[model samples]
Target chain A: MADDIAGRGDPIKTLQLMWGRIEAPKRGPKSKLAVADLVRAAVRLADEEGIDAVSTRRVAEAVGISPMSFYTHIPDKAVLLDLMLDAVARPADGSEEAQAFRPEDWRANVAFVAREYRAFYLRHPWVLQVATHRPVLGPNTMRAYDYFLAAFDGLNLSEVEMDLSVTMVANYVHGAVRDVARARMVKELTGMSDDEWWHAIAPFLETVDFSPYPVASRIGPVVGELYGLGDPDRAFEFGLECLLDGLAVMVERKGGRR
Target chain B: MADDIAGRGDPIKTLQLMWGRIEAPKRGPKSKLAVADLVRAAVRLADEEGIDAVSTRRVAEAVGISPMSFYTHIPDKAVLLDLMLDAVARPADGSEEAQAFRPEDWRANVAFVAREYRAFYLRHPWVLQVATHRPVLGPNTMRAYDYFLAAFDGLNLSEVEMDLSVTMVANYVHGAVRDVARARMVKELTGMSDDEWWHAIAPFLETVDFSPYPVASRIGPVVGELYGLGDPDRAFEFGLECLLDGLAVMVERKGGRR
Candidate 1:
């Protein structure tokens, strides 16, 4: 356990050895494998086959290395998943938008961040599941959170209130994405298109007496029709707008505190 | 199937016969195996062994019937799941509160419904996963939805706004309960007492620099502390208050648009 430094055969210093491998300079004039390279490969695998398919052996093979070789950089599969999440969550520069932030432009800023975050999740649905659980304190996640906090800085909210607001938004985004992703997975696995399945289940909807739930029942059809627009981005945006609208009212009532 | 129904069965009706057997009544003089019975059994199985342990066969056996017998009332495992969901989602009696509704009473009413709904989910965590996937049109589900929608009926929100508001509240309840359930499962499977695990993870949390994500980082400890409170009632109340506080502003702004 004492001789493997970046695959040189050290055991006792496993974590340190892995960190060294991750930080090692590129060996070739062009490129050799790096932690980032491995993370990218893992993300690609997850995108194609779902997160359940990802493993040290699978990622190593994708990177043209032996499974044991992966130990040089990542301590375990959990660490690899963390790194992959971080790689995908790299802070959105949205510099153009960030620079545009102004006291009067708070709503726009909120909308922009929400849209960008939704886009990020849309591009990597697996991230939603992973990030919601076992949230790794990674650089990318921090960056994303930083942008959100900064957006609300001018609202003069109490620490607790601010925390609650951020939690609400984050959970909303996470939950919405999870819903959209599951819907997509169901579509892929069942081979029954969303509308086709809805039609099959329509009889159930039609026979149910919703007088007891007039609001939901009345709007059920419209919501059902919007089910899998085959695009999460739009659904997310719609939900976000409504959430922000609700938040906007809160902001005003709190005397513009933030 | 005809023999069971008419004393002579047709070959083409074998499949139907099998389904009828699956749906046959359970034991006891009062027992008339219905979809409700299977759903109740399925819920019990889920609560005892987790959702993965629930299947048509398991449910049938639990009710003292052949595996094939479950098909009669439920048609398929998916429908069994749907039935279980509806059974668990039976409406909360908000009539007492609804009769006393006032502008200021809205928050408490919403909180009550949310708490009841959360309690329902926590009692049967498996329902959280299913509830998040699709729209609910079952009688029980509708009754629950109507209770929520009725809370805000006189508050002056537009039809669309009212729908969106309900969705947001439902999303929050579902997400929070799901998180708690997952945490509970982890604690059970890992065999680590919550305190022991938290102490072990504390050092890592302290060593991690979360300055970049001031809000999430600062609030991480609070979130972690609240992690396994497992009382869906408490979490639901907390989130519901925040949401209602947010919605109160919306109500004020709309100037009683109803």
Candidate 2:
């Protein structure tokens, strides 16, 4: 044991040394660890084995450390999970660098954010579970929200109205992407693609009498295609355009009110 | 055993009898059991004990029947779950009775439906899990879709556009309500109301510098309020209006195109 300790670094001694450094009466060198590294590994695990595979120990193992060692950096598994969610959702930088932007130019900005957000969700399907519900806010999460809010700064509206507008748009994108991801996952797992799944289920759709409910039958085919195509990004773009146009009306109405 | 069987009416026998009657081996009295009754019982179980508490045996016990008897009317738990989802999402019956209403009049109708849908989800939070992810095409599900699609009639958009429009609106409401319900449940279980929870975590939120990011900080307040407010119905209404306004723009644009 002494030779092992002398020849190779002592596991406990090394841990103690690291712990000493971290606890060192002063913050320096940053322990060669970061929240981003942990989040990145968690995302990788989620992508490889699905969201269910993500656990503090697994993430710690991926980072080559004891599970207990993670607690020094993060509070708990929930914190790690929340951080992972934010990391995946962090918006693309330089969105604002495109200077030709305007506040009333809701269409372009909304579409841009929607596409970016959809891409984020697609890359990390597990994030949908975290995003769709109330979340424990993390650094990355706050940043993404700030970016969205900043995009809407020039639009004429009350603080509350701006808040509501941003919420609606974000929720819409989150919902649409989630549905798309679910369909995709099902296709991947069942070997029955969206089109095949729809074909199999089409008979059931037809057998049901929808005359008393005419609209569903009228639009069922189209809704079917939208979902069946399995392109969340397209859906996000389409819906974002519709929502922004709606907001434009509000902007006009606000202008009139003022 | 005999006494227990007498008291319980032979679980398998009861189910087989109900099944045989419904199937009509020859021409027997149609099974007295109704799908509506089963769905109601299931909903009650979900509401009172949460969705996880719902099961075939529990539902059967609630209805004072054998678990096996349920299969006569519903194929399995999944079918029962689907039926419950449809029941909760039942549409307003008299929507089409107003023949004189114009396309713009459709907004109020859609809003009304949106409100009802939100209430349905609030009343049965468990339904959100199944409804959002699963592709169960039950009668009521079709009927609800038909009603929403009908609201867009005479708008002059292609079938595909109309379908996407309706989906955008429906999905927004569904996703919004799901988020609200989850927050409410978490609050209830944790014994910390939404505001209390936020205040408790405020330090964490403040320390989490998401400045370089925009979406989280900009939208955090709204998301915070959404959770803080005991009722999410108002938020749902606000979002529905935004979505409708967006669709209205599309309708106007299409008319201009024509």
Candidate 3:
């Protein structure tokens, strides 16, 4: 992400790798490994050991290839990171999950879009840690961007409104994803569930007086026990619904097709 | 974070430290530094460096104290992390910023809450990197939580609805904060603005055919140029407006207090 953001490496080459315009020569090659093999391996390393674990050397070893050979498919760690994320960002078409995301009404489609992206992010939790400001202009990344943009199709949003709507929904989902990922990470790292962790800490908390914070004193446990770790799913639903309603109001105020 | 979640430390001690109930005895041979001094130093380290830069040993050096004495103020790294976040979570009550956040109508108040948090998160970018699922139960943390929950007061929401409302708002704001932070971090780390970075890569993007993504083709450059590395302030306003509208719809739907 740093390398890409810094304008290092060949942008054309990164785009080429992204669009699959260039590929390793198949004939008379020492190995027939595709560029995707490296990206997939890198993704696996990230899923297991975090994004920091993803390196050309590590991925090459995982793919049973040499460092020099790995570079034949992926340009650099930055380009490799770009490809890995685009692979995750690519719409999961033809999968069982994709089937469930079939669009209905505009509102249902909007909800589906949020749900799909949330699931997509969860599947590759480390991807959220990557740079989000400058979305990689890869083919798969473009396809994912199109998918989100089309969610509000025929909804009467102006050009700018359409773009901002997509951005806000994505921001909301990513926020939710971060919360869930935090919970999952804590559990994975500490080898304890939120339930057990809270239970373990309950003894100490029991001694603290809560007379001052009326709202927290009353609602804290109800929320804490129910949502020990943040409940992103529930929060997403609530937020998305409100967001959709808010959009409807704006559209109505603007009054139909412009 | 790992230690706190795993329930390894004395929560009472952490609470005491967080609430300012415990302080180094000042009458003896020890220096005049207080727990706030250590926390303030840690906050500074986290702001300049990342959160990982903060540790008992490092903070002790920053505060001109010994690690043993630092331990006297903080129990462990996890407790230190909790205290650090709680400090960030502490509202800028009398500061000029808080003066602007004076309560108004419910909708205005909701917007204020989101904006306040966005500003708060931006002030301490590293704080967002810490685990967020289980918020530290310190006085400042609870105080912040109370302030959030109170945004919807007298809106006729049930207890559960009121709770969910606050959760969704924080999620949305944090979402916005992440986008802004990503842009800021990229610029700070690379010594190049997103505009400069994009200009460097524009030549490669110019050759691509964006026809398939007509929505992206037309709107991409507009948003990309205007937003550069994600315009969270604009995105937050749009999202918050939609969220407020949506909440109004729900409130109207429920019809009255239970």
Candidate 4:
């Protein structure tokens, strides 16, 4: 259920559409509308409201186009979603900026990529709901993937190790971002801040015999206080440091980083 | 929309019910159902048909009770979900089993816990959908949390570091499982294995310019081949090793483990 893109229409066709390989229909009256325009409209809707709020009718209404015209540009919600992801997947930073990093500083380059990817997911968490396994390879998505792959240059990792290493960083950042984002959503949905909610449950918690959990009992308060400070970013920062440290150790053990 | 236990009725009341601190209704015409029964039914339904399949009416029907009677035991779906998580969150391994590890073997203990937690998520993926942020602290959940916290005994980490270290492992495992699970679901949904899908796209992928992405172009084949072997678990294993390695390094840097 997590990453099923079943309704996204045909993967090949969606990829073609995403890459802008297919030209606009010549038979229809030349409309000013473009696929990018339709994708932008849908992404805006998903950003403000969740992805469920995005519909063909709703997007068409938002963009001041007829549903039929919208269909010509993108056939269904699935393809539109692929386009939305591709749109956001565009490397927000310039290629020149990426290239400016020294080739030897692979770790820094990786951290840069990780930070960017985390920010991208935070901006459009609906991206998390879509299937990342068999993603429709658009230009932006491909460029982004390529950018990440480039970060491992001369790291001395085996081919498989390279992929898996990038993936580990990605998985950690994704989990961290999702935790932060989900915690925020919980706050909104429960109509209570983390402090308010913890305060509400504190009395009940006090009754529990936490004596058995010396570590959790001692540290739980500190952890809760950190979260209560309204800065979810600290967790991410800590995680990132640990991850990079681990990566260095991995590289060293695997015959040293170039 | 990730962590919202809204309308779970009251947090304190729900906790009491979950902890079995409150007695089952003595006044319900001697119905055989207990709250645990309803929760088990819900968990079974979720396991078989996914979380969305778990509705109040459906659970009530599954338990052979009137929906009204079910409501007396659990007021709403949110609270029911809390109970469901608590039910699954129970420490499957005995603490005696957990304590069998030597105190100095914290790394092994942490790895043991990570693998177990990963297995739990794979079995009950719906557990991923619930609001983990403001978890309804039932006894089972607390036990599980405490079990995780205890893994760092004598690691010399501050309370905050211990909490974050545990969290880092949890996040990495959660993310890894989601990826593996999502990949399997995508395979089923697309009716094409990852290799078959890549083969389908390879011809088109070849048409695209690869000059700009030397690293992706070089290693993409290897990455695809690994997925082709039908072993998604490799990434998780690699990640776990790296995380533990990283944790060891972190502990050493911060005044050593044990």
Model number with the top TM-score: 4
Q: Which residue pairs does candidate 4 place in steric collision?
A: none
- Summing lDDT over every window of 10 consecutive residues in candidate 2 chain A, give the lowest-scoring window: A1-10
TM-score between model 4 and native:
0.87
The digit string of per-residue lDDT tens for model 4 on A26-69 reads 79588787888888888898787766567788889888988776
Candidate-wise lDDT, in order: 0.60, 0.61, 0.73, 0.74
Q: Lowest summed-lDDT stretch of 10 residues in model 1 chain A? A: A1-10
lDDT of 2 by residue, B10-66 (tens): 223223322232344467667666766887898888787666567778888888789
State the lDDT of candidate 3 residue by residue for B1-258, as single tens digits: 111233346555777787776655768677578888898899988889666567778899998878788877667767777788888776776763344323346787778778888889888877666654355888777777777777777767766788888887888788777767767866776676767767877887787788878767777777766766556677788888888888889877886421
Interface RMSD of each: 12.1, 14.2, 4.4, 3.3
Residues A103-184, candidate 1: write the lDDT tens digits.
6767777777766666677777666445222334456666777677677766866555565666667666666666666667
For model 2 the local lDDT of residue A38 reads: 79
What is the lDDT, from 0 to 100, of the residue A172 in candidate 2?
83
Task: Please state the Cα-based DockQ of model 1 relative to the true two-chain complex.
Answer: 0.17
Those runs of model 3 whose alpha carbons end farther than 4 Å from true positions after fitting are A1-17, A20-35, A52-57, A65-79, A96-104, A224-231, A255-258, B1-37, B52-60, B65-79, B96-104, B224-230, B255-258
**Which candidate comes out best when scored by DockQ?**
4
> What TM-score against the true chain A does chain A of each candidate get?
0.72, 0.70, 0.83, 0.84
Please state every model's RMSD to the true fold in angstroms. 9.1, 10.6, 4.6, 3.5
- TM-score (chain B) of candidate 4: 0.84
